[model samples]
Target: MNAIGIDELRGLAMLPPTASGHSPFAEPCLLLRLGGTAERRLADWLRQLPCPVIGIGEADAPLAASCDVVVQNEQEAQPLLAGVRRSPVAATVLVQLLRASESLPVADALTMESLAYATLQGGAEFRRWLEGRPAPPVPPAETGPAVLLAREADTLRLTLNRPARRNSMSVEMRDALVEALQLALADDDIRRVRIDGAGKCFSTGGELDEFGTAPDPATAHAVRSLTVPGRLLAACADRAEARVHGACIGSGIEFPAFAGRIVAAPDAWFQLPELQFGLIPGAGGCVSLPRRIGRQRTACMVLGGKRIDARTAKDWGLVDAIESSR
Candidate 1:
């Protein structure tokens, strides 16, 4: 389509300008467009407009809800983001497309209102569009040794090796951890599993990068893998050890809480901010955390979404030992 053909986008308008001398972008539209000449033309138009136009770059589409216009096109869909540095667009809308041209005006594509509902309003309107999209499965590459392995006849040492992404638990890491835990559980020679991080923080909890793109079925599968192993680990809750520091949040706290003993540095802070993300403790934490700290305290910690110092964690019956290294 020609760059001038983009004027048709005016027909997809959802909001009218509140005042004269105002361009629609002043009342901005979250624009979703495939990267190409058309996208560049739209971007140029948006730049000249009198308001905020949110440009959703191809990769940052998850944050598209905050924008007003979303454009999709193949010609401008290249990953090499341009005009992004040039627009007053509140955000850009980029749909994942292959072969660049697939992003061209297709009859079977998302609508502006639907985009607003699914992304801007954070509703399920995009669920149908997302139904078939899923990350291809990894080849089960060996990421590291089993998290729990017998170092001595009576002692097991478990280390989370993903120090790069703040030790965020990827699907691969979760699976590896599960396999490690299973091996540890089956070994008659092992007595205690000592869990610690390889770097600064113990863990930042679940990986959210895959949130919108992860198909519900795969997400469910991942959830089962993450929590089932967590349940099993919690079940083997005898004389386990946790050496933690830095920000321990959500599943981080949930996982460490399951240890028979939790050792936190004096500077360590524990928190559960799942409520902020519209989720509950999925790692058997609703039962496990409450069992340790009581339902009232669990509610306080989760609902409050506040930092719980080491002393507070100890006082709430959440932690067992405070490390001296802080």
Candidate 2:
């Protein structure tokens, strides 16, 4: 809960040396408040800080890139970030990965995220979540295809068709999406690709029944390498547009984030609840989202476990426009 001023931070660097190389930021997090000029001057140094530096005061676009997360008021952030501060290693590593992923190719970035996610899956926090989770009942089998694909003139249309289950991203859906995306990639005649869902909600995230079913963390990573629709979506992003409505959780938001343009219906709401499962956004979100919104806001959303409505998504540049749901 304690915060350090820029002047005080500079002063500590001037302190007498110790044989053990004492670090002033012994706490799990470093809450920092600084004038605009001070932050800009120490930007490079702050980026290399040993602990997560949470900026206090109004959001500064430039300074946000240097910190793990920022809050207009530190008091407000204390409770919001309690989980992340408690699990400092995961949060720290997530932010570090987000920072490094921006310049990497989408495939490489996703690979990095999967490796980190697998590491966390083996950690105690994730194991605790899995232990606490009740076994899910078998969902009724739907009769039709998980996705619908149609080629219309020069445009390709893809829809998430499992409305009865809120279009949850099951393994079937993942494979279907990969096939649809692959079709577009192979056909030079397809100029525009439009993606949307068939029912009220675009997607409610991954299917609950599928959670924790992976044999092991390593196997999970292996499966994700082949099945992630986000990477395919990114490859075709140059000509892709997505229309999302209602609950856009987890894979819902992560997939659309790879599109060139995203339009949200008034009812759309977004959340990333994967941290509750003791994992980060393994669906290419750590890469896709940070490139759209800054790493700070993305970290806040994932770590804070908050819902962001459509308006907030637009303001944050997550979506290109707001429109009636298709």
Identify the candidate with maximal lDDT: 2
Candidate 2 Cα misplacement greater than 4 A, ranges? 11-26, 36-42, 61-64
Error of 2 at 219 (Å): 2.6
- Please count the clashing residue pairs in each candidate, in the order shown: 39, 0
**Model 2, range 1-326, lDDT digits (tens) per residue?**
67777677666545432211222223556677745455445576666555556778767544555777888787767854575655656666676677678688888999999999888878877778778888877776677889998888999999999998999999899999999999999999999999999888999988977777789989999998988898988998999999999999998999899999999999999999887776788888898998899778888888787899999999999999998847
Q: In order, what lDDT does every prediction score?
A: 0.51, 0.81
lDDT of 1 at 221: 41
Worst 10 residues of 2 by lDDT: 16-25
lDDT by residue for model 1 (130-201), tens: 354465444233455525344866787778777666676666667776777777678777788888876688
